[model samples]
Target: MRNSPLHGLRVVEIGTMLAAPFATHILSQLGAEVIKVEPPAGDPTRSLVRGGPSGTFIAYSHGKKSACIDLSTPGGRAALHKLLAQSHALVHNLAPKAARKLGVGREECAALNPELVYCHIRGYAAGPQQDDLASNPVAEAATGVMEGNRINGRPSRLGPSYHDQFAGAYAVIGMLAALLQAKTGAADRHVEVGLYETGLHVAARDLVGVQLKTQLLGRAEREPHGEFAMPGYGAYLTADERWLYLLMLTDGHWLKFCQALDLPQAADPGLARLKDRKKAREQVEELVGRAIGALPFDAAVARLKAAGVGCTEVLPLERVLEAPQAQSPGKLREVAFRGLQFQVPEFPRHPDADDAPATLPPAALGQHTREVLEQAGLSAAECAALLDSGAVRAVDPAGFAWAPVRATS
Candidate 1:
């Protein structure tokens, strides 16, 4: 019953994929009344994978309502405009050309509601390469992330959905700033965020470093890209095939690590010194790897921890879900829906000690269609008519899948 940070704010979401929806998802978690406007076939993310809800969709769309509308239709567009007129903000990720065709572009929406903050998410900003197609991997490749991730001759992409998540965070920050500006009586503002731009921003340090050296940081670069810069900060495979990632940056921790591994000569040989260890990176890695390989995973981790070195077992997805850290007090919560238990991360606490409400499981497609329409002032008859006219549809308990229209020759 307590007021949340975003209490009383209303957001209209017209995004199908990750970035824009993710921004609105934060607003929703902070108590905004977010109404997600899905196409007749629904957001592509809803059907991106088989079985259960699209994990990405479920994660981003928790605590929001949904409505299926065929925006290309005149009646649907009118309904969307009405929704926009009542909303405080609009967030979308439609392609530039598609947004123009649907009449939901920033200029058009601002014309309808001068106070509405409109946020647009794109694959790239306006420039010579503005029109280029950029999915997450493509953006990563373009921004040098994928290339920099290669080490020891093994080139690999970053872990799941990094670009989408990063861009989403940036878009949310922009929208939040616009909201503050609106409260200050500033006119409605249009904000744009691009995945490629966010990716480049994330790699700013590496890019700048390479520029300074007059050489591009390519996949062929042998230098480590991440915390690997620290001589003792990296992953080591244990005798039991499990990995133990440890960080021993300070001199005290390095000494403790050598003592923990019972390698007295490790310190005497000057491997404990930062500069010397970095200079002999390969030799240090080999010695550490050999020591780790000699011990069972759990025992090695216990030894390192007992010696005051910060170390943890590298957890896989399933293990992460059941991690002790995740189950600790005030960490994660489990919500049940339709005989399924869903675990979601709790919101970050506000400095003033206020917190958002407990999360609701993601809606089952347009699960609250009738309720949402009624709340929006549509009569029951009108709601039925809209459904019958193919302008809207309710979530089917049986579920549905996306089938994008294909061009025929």
Candidate 2:
């Protein structure tokens, strides 16, 4: 982190669940000092999976410090105000009303520190619809994306909590842009992002089609048994029953794909045009499938790559942990808890230390409460009082190093 870009910067995160936490986690990885303000009982996500230190919490909060501050109390608010006065950025994903009540609203915090990059993330954008409660699934259902992903005649959520993650990512973008603006002079410290609006942007292309009254083509309308928009451009089974995905959208891709698999159609000028190939979908898929099905998955991928055709074997999400591409150095970073370690892909890997070992693990609830409060300028007596009153909470400093998990059974 000494050589990292945001090494000396401080970011205060008042967040729970995914969106706000994820944004700060990325900043933590980028070398920002991220202090996650948790509630007295700790973030709910801490128990969302296997009880303590759940996977959801681990994935979203690596390398972050947790400080429990009860914003509902005057003592807590005073302490947070002191901390924000010296911070570079503050981010939260609470409801608009809840934020105002907590005194962490953009305006409130910005008044304390004008140059602070303040990010407010919520369910919906401003206006009459702003307060409607929404999380990932509700936002997706409100927008057209969920309907577009209908399966078996029922609208279904796409596997991941993509909307939450996307909102968090956009919030980071907004904050980084706002931070840059500060270097030029008086900066607009306020940045806002809404999950509902993020969903709108995710479905923007389809929205454009509707307004133009033009045909909107997408995988949702794919043919029965086809996983993508066109023949031979989807997941297929090989001789070993392993799934392989192919991407051949253009005329050149089609030509290369045919030659790669040694299909006789390579010599047919009549099938050169994409439109003609579409017209002959049934038989074309049959020939393509037969050729690919004759070879094992590895051989099929090799032949396709040799011809400059795009292809890959399809593995389930869990199998990605050991996938060669994912296992390669600089592709992932480690997160640990109770002496157990796991890895997650790191986006925009650290510049000077791509292969560096993980330096910090996710903190326990209120893990750094005492240390952070002291740094925030709270007197030891004040800190002790707040901790006693339950306005703040702190785990023993020794708890920083997680002990090995022991068998309970």
Candidate 3:
């Protein structure tokens, strides 16, 4: 196997849902041994969709180990402390107050492992609104993303869980930086990433533009802005009712686009300049709409490609998976769990190489309790006792298939 950038590093993740786990997912990809510590009931995301628990769980937790402990129990806290003491880092998304109640707060964990790079992902930073509990939608709503999405009039949520995922990415970057600092002799660092803050940053360009009132030359909106009124820059519905997104950024591409649609007048006299193009947006849009509506989806796509116009069918999720771009070597990976097959997208190539594995199936709740406890230097008897006493529990009493080293005889 190729060497991973995070090889030999150990991370214990106590975060449920997205933010912290997503950050650790990046670390796990980079070859870090990330042990996800979950409650006996497991991370709620494990049962997110209607499907049985396994699929959803496996999707988020691929390439990681699981350990289930009842943090409410003293024995459970002892076992967790043991794991924390031996870990290089801990990433958690628990609320500060909740974490303090659970005894895994930064102060508590850092005292156990001073060298640990501890990252706390929160929904909001300490502020007037610090006490507000925010989920993805709340964060989006607070950050103006929801408003941006509804710019056309009707308010709606963005398709994906952007706030959670972006916060996770931010947390990952912070974790890596903190790890580097620790290597260079810095003390353990406590990094906090707020999902609301991430949402705010994700809307940075728009926010900045609105704040600064910086519009594009001769236009009322900002540059790189989407053109709802322009014919070439927005989605066009085909005869089959599928949408096609056309992007003709340059004059050359615009000419080709006009040629492809057999509407040479689209780039003619009155439409020659960009200002004129904007002025005639409604007419241009109607013309383009009629042209696209006249052609079958594939035929239109072929015509655009042949004419050197950048185009792509607005694909459904299933179609996207089957697209040639998705099937390229090293682009996607197939993973199986209990005879169930699923696919996960591979990481983009980095100058150093892909940091993490292509796929890490999610874990069963408390699947690695016995194994993890044993790795933390608990004796078999002690592990069994803890389980029997309800200090820890494994979803599968048989424990996970992975090995947890036993202490030397």
> Global CA lDDT of candidate 1, please?
0.79
lDDT of 2 by residue, 1-409 (tens): 5776688889999988889998888788778999999877678887655446567688778778888889899988988998899889998989888988989887788789988898988998796888877899988998876776878989888868999999999999998888788888856888889999999998787677565553444323323431554677877899999999899788899899988888888889878887888788887888888888899998999999999999887878788778887887777777667767788667666445643325578787888988998897888998999999888888754533434458898
Lowest lDDT block of 10, candidate 1 = 216-225
By summed lDDT, which 10 consecutive residues of candidate 3 come out lowest? 397-406
Model 3 C-alpha lDDT per residue in residues 261-343, reported as the tens digit of each score: 78977548787666777777778778778999999999999999998888888878777889887887766668776556888
Order by lDDT, highest first: 2, 1, 3
The Cα error of candidate 2 at residue 115, in Å, is 1.8
lDDT by residue (tens digit), candidate 1, 1-409: 2578888888988887788888888888778888999986778877775444566777788888888878888767876787788788888888888888998988899888898888888889788876666778888888887776775767567768788878878987898898888779887578888889999899898777766666654433435555657676888899989989988687677788889999874547577678877898788778888988999998998898888889988888878868877787665657665565778776666445555765767777778777767776678898898788887788888785444457899
Superposed on all Cα atoms, the candidates' RMSDs to the truth, in angstroms, are 5.2, 3.6, 7.0
Native RMSD of candidate 2 (Å): 3.6
- Model 3 residue runs over 4 Å out of place are 54-56, 151-154, 214-231, 350-360, 397-409
My TM-score estimates for the predictions, one after another, are: 0.88, 0.90, 0.88
